[model samples]
Target: MNLVENLVVFAHGKESGPWGTKITHLAETARGRGFEVMSPDYSHTHDPRERVAQLLALAPTAKRLVLVGSSMGGYVSAQACATLKPQALFLMAPALYFTGWDEEPQGVPALCSVVHGWHDDIVPMERGLRFAKSNHATLHVLNSDHGLNDQLAALALLFGDFLDQVKTEIL
Candidate 1:
């Protein structure tokens, strides 16, 4: 895979910290592959809109960016994507059905990939599938739950593949 030097920002779920399991593992994986990853702590707010604002505020203005949003953070990332227009969007069990947030995203990144767990009770896989279909994003249905802890290996692989795809597309 070609090495990408873009700034990768990871947004954790509502109840998760910046150092959550998935984010931490992905950050390590990204770093090993020569990526600069940033996980901002948005554990303070459960509100998706507020978290979206927080993420947008922390987003870098000068470099290429890839936004990885998990669960509620997925919703936040999608919302932030309107403004940041990152090079790519990687979503994990994205919560696209939050009330009052009802607009199909516009100006999406060049590459959008969403991975949803088949066993996720918090946000059903069907919902994610519908969202992915609507947004025309590549979807990966893994055998896991809402937290997707059981599929870390698969997630890591997906993340790496996404980086390579983005790098290939941009370069």
Candidate 2:
């Protein structure tokens, strides 16, 4: 298959920087697959609005963009990409009902998939379900908690599958 000129950006979860396990793993995977990756460090700002601005600033306008956001970062990615319109969005345990963000989540005009842990206590899977439904996204429910650390291998596999799907459908 021809490799598309794609840029993958990973938005880390709240309290986690850009070098966390998820971000690192996915970045490596994307790189190994011949895709450029960016995991921006938003540790300086916890405010969702500020994060959205930061993420948007890093988004590339010249290439096909794929965004992967986790937890609060997922919220940032969702809001930032609403108008940016990337090729695909992969959200893991997105915090949708947080303060300073939109009360009602809007649909992203791109192929989007949401992966949430069923046992998540911090953000809860229900919020993911609601967001996915509202945005017409595919929701993947896993057997883990908010951090989803216990299921890294599975998450990586699912992410690989997502990239493959994007390769076929969007790239």
Number of the predicted model whose lDDT against the real structure is largest = 1
Give each model's whole-structure lDDT. 0.83, 0.82
Query: Which stretches of candidate 2 lie above 4 Å from their native place?
Result: 1-4, 105-107
Q: Looking at model 1, report the run of 10 residues with the lowest lDDT sum.
A: 55-64
* Cα lDDT, model 2, residue 127: 92
Q: Candidate 1, residue 111: CA error in Å?
A: 0.4
Measured against the true structure, the TM-scores of the candidates, in listed sequence, are 0.92, 0.90
Can you tell me which runs of candidate 1 are displaced by over 4 Å? 1-5
**Model 2 C-alpha lDDT per residue in residues 61-148, reported as the tens digit of each score:** 5356788899999988888776667888899999988666757645474588998998999997999999888888899899999988
Model 2: lDDT to the true structure: 0.82
- State which candidate has the highest TM-score: 1
Candidate 1 lDDT over residue span 37-70, tens digit each: 8888888777778988887787554345888889
